[model samples]
Target: MLSTALAAPAAAAAPRYQRYVALGDSYAAVGTLTKVRSAPIGCARATDNYPSGVAARLAPATFVDISCGGAETPDLTTPQEVPLGVNPAQFSALTPDTDLVTVSIGGNDVGFGEIVRKCAELSFGDPFGAPCRAHYTAGGTDVLAARIAELAPKITAVVDGITARSPNATVVVVGYLRILPPRWGCWPLVPFAIGDVAYFDGVQRSLNATIGGRAEAAGARFVNPGLTTGHDVCQLPGKKWVEGLVPTSLSMPVHPNARGQAHVAGLVAAALSQ
Candidate 1:
């Protein structure tokens, strides 16, 4: 009777998720959207970000999001300048008692930003036959693949480092959301060379796989957003969760919109419940 009276509650049967720490790059920053955390310059963080949303839903816990725009794996491993703010890097915010950690990185490492810039640059003159799209569609660029492979070990190291710090924490690695669909629908605004959209998706997918594999190897759960495939940005408004090449509002083109962030928050929340 004494043991039964002292037994842990059902909610405490499994490790109760309490402290939440988020780490990653621009895509996860939730900047440029309303309620996002702002810095004096560079990429700003957002309170409406998925982590923020999840934190609100899972109240009564500490929430710390260290995500920034243009963040890289080395940013977590070493001390680097905070592009806009005073803080050094996102990892600096993490501690030994973190109950949860979410990460989505490596896109900037592959020069995805450059790709978008080039695409936008070329689209101005030749929307369809742009040299940037041409080079990418040629199927010879191993840059993205090579970059992701190199990052795999670094990401795994971060996971090990985190676990070393918080022996009882649950590390969650979030994958990239789909940018383009298997098929391109809109022209001009989202025009790309034949099959280029799929190619881009494949690269993003490969990069995400590397992140997931490494996270799993380090004993973390991998949360992939690819499950929202058909609902990628290219879809008609009200149907798409992620935004396409062009944003509906005056915001960053490639990053997630508020709706998208909400979806991500739900996913993260579900993972924590498990």
Candidate 2:
């Protein structure tokens, strides 16, 4: 009889959770910082953006940034109105096997930009304050309750859907970075009433709260930069992450700049590591 050698069992490979996908709006897109490329895989699409920053540190196998400028919650699940060069297609890359996913949205849905634009032009000279609070609470035209109510469920659905699609993936919902000081008396730079600044901040805070609550319910992570509130664009030059009303350039208004993006990415990486 010939002696036969038994074959050794094969070694199991390490679990691979290296794919990272980023989904969100102009804040995440960093449209103003760089030109967007048609390439599906490369940081040619706003390489300086926060998600890109995170990926650079993590170095995942695949980094899919389906983030579009001006994308809202509904835009993630359905086709949306498209402006030139902006992608409106809903994100479909995230699946049950996806490794990691992060989103930064809901600002457009609540028309927060409009508030800032309007407030940026307000004059509080005579009254020592702008009509910011009145404009927000008048309940007929400028009140945001309806918009907030509508946004709550829509954003919740997006988070829940993402969780269902990527049960094992680490879903992280990032909150909006601050855009103004807590009191907003930046004068010509911000050019808004202190009350208006407070109102805008309140809106942002409320939106972040909703996002945190929803993400918690979906068993995902919610990262808020609430601690960085006073360090917004209205702050002195070196202290701000976002730009003021009159931007240093034609980039996204009141959004996080490169420094801001770095801070955001650092926070996100820390969260994912945990």
Candidate 3:
């Protein structure tokens, strides 16, 4: 009986999810989707985001979510000032004892916001003429490609920092969700030229490839979501994981919605299990 009692205590001592930290930009930050309430202030974090979803599924002992909107690679090391409050450097949330870490970043670093904005603005002139693509490649140089190349080193640095800060943590880098439809885009909903849709999709693919490659090289697991099959923003309202340019719900255009968050959380959980 004494031996049985001692063994029970030993089993109970096994650590579960001791600590988890999520970091990144709007994609990582969960926000309102179809009027669903989440974090009320800075970062617009939603309670139903992948971090939160993972926590619920894994029941981590401790979880901290510092993801913010408009975050760049530098924001991982520097403070970010948002309307609700100032978000500390994302890496600040990490410690050697951190058990798990997940980040979905780098899009903003590649000037995605500017690209989208420019695309939207140029769409008005010629909805079917690929004006956005022409504008970006006006000088026969792909500016966006240059931006991605510039950010590659930064992403590597981030992965190195996370490894340095939490040497034992299971670091998972999440990739961006698909934003364009397969084959054909919903012109009225996304407003991008037919050619521009393919162009943008190619850019996203490039970003994902870079992120996946960097994460693998840094000894971290990468979750690609593999959502491109049929879960693009142009999918039917309920089928889409990412919202279109003109959101059908309260979700921000080009961002993931609740379903998307849940889907990513599942992917993260699966990765952890492996």
Candidate 4:
């Protein structure tokens, strides 16, 4: 009788994650990081993106990836109209049967691209001064910081909506990789004015903190890529996870490369296992 009871317990296995849906923006889609051989143009959904890596390791029964470049918080519910194609609402992929969902968004909504572009443009003239910082912080206001604060609620709403759609799914909100070094940045490689480098880094950190807090508040697990230590873009070739202003690989400047995506996948996998 004792043997029978023990065997029964052993025979009953833990449930596996059968369905997974990946949703988010350029970072999540791995835009310009690698080629999207099969995805529609402008979607930039790379085959080797973090989502794909996670799906491979988990080996889920169903995997749906709806991430696209330039997606904003609204794009999660509204169809995103791309230049050459239109992507369906990202949340449409989520169902009650979904066992897992992962998202990496909000950078576009907060104007990260514009900030980078403006910084790069200004850096050409003032390579040693904090020109980018001065531009955004003009009139005694940090516009980018204010934008991140405003987007916090939107992030929470997106998580809540995901939960409403897939009550039983384990949702993971992934944060961005570090792009700058701690003390100084690679001026020649990134071209951000010497003083503006730290300013940009601070902005990225604040954004990640906001994202992490919102994910926690909405009952979703947050996976920080933890790339701040030695994986910044300024690191040596093999050690760097993010690409510089002029990328060495196919990845876009200031975004994660293939190595960064793989590392983020590993972090997500670890979170799931726990």
Which candidate ranks first by lDDT, i.e. highest?
4
Count of clashing residue pairs in every prediction? 4, 0, 1, 0
For model 4 the TM-score comes to: 0.91
lDDT of 3 by residue, 9-56 (tens): 555454467999999888889546533333436677777888888888
lDDT of 3: 0.83
lDDT of 4 by residue, 1-274 (tens): 4687766656644347889999999788873444784445677788888999999898888989999888999999999988688989999999999989999999998998898889889988988899999999999999999999999999999999999999999999998888787646777567788999889988888999999999998999999874457888788777888888777778877777888899889999998899
What is the lDDT of every predicted structure here? 0.73, 0.73, 0.83, 0.86
The TM-score of candidate 2 is 0.84
- TM-score per model over all chains: 0.83, 0.84, 0.91, 0.91
**Greater-lDDT candidate between 3 and 4:** 4
Off by over 4 Å in 2: 1-16, 38-45, 85-88, 124-127, 139-142
Model 3 TM-score, all chains together? 0.91
Worst 10 residues of 1 by lDDT: 8-17
Candidate 4 lDDT (Cα, 0 to 1): 0.86
Q: Can you give the lDDT of residue 194 in candidate 3? A: 74
lDDT of 1 at 116: 64
What are the per-residue Cα lDDT tens digits for candidate 2 across 1-274?
5334446556755434577889988778773456555543222247778888888988887888888766778778765555444354546878666788999888888887787766665544513475766767775665676677777777678877887887778888888887766675676657777666676677778778887887778677988865576678767666678877666643556777777877899998898788
Residue 40 lDDT in model 4?
Answer: 54
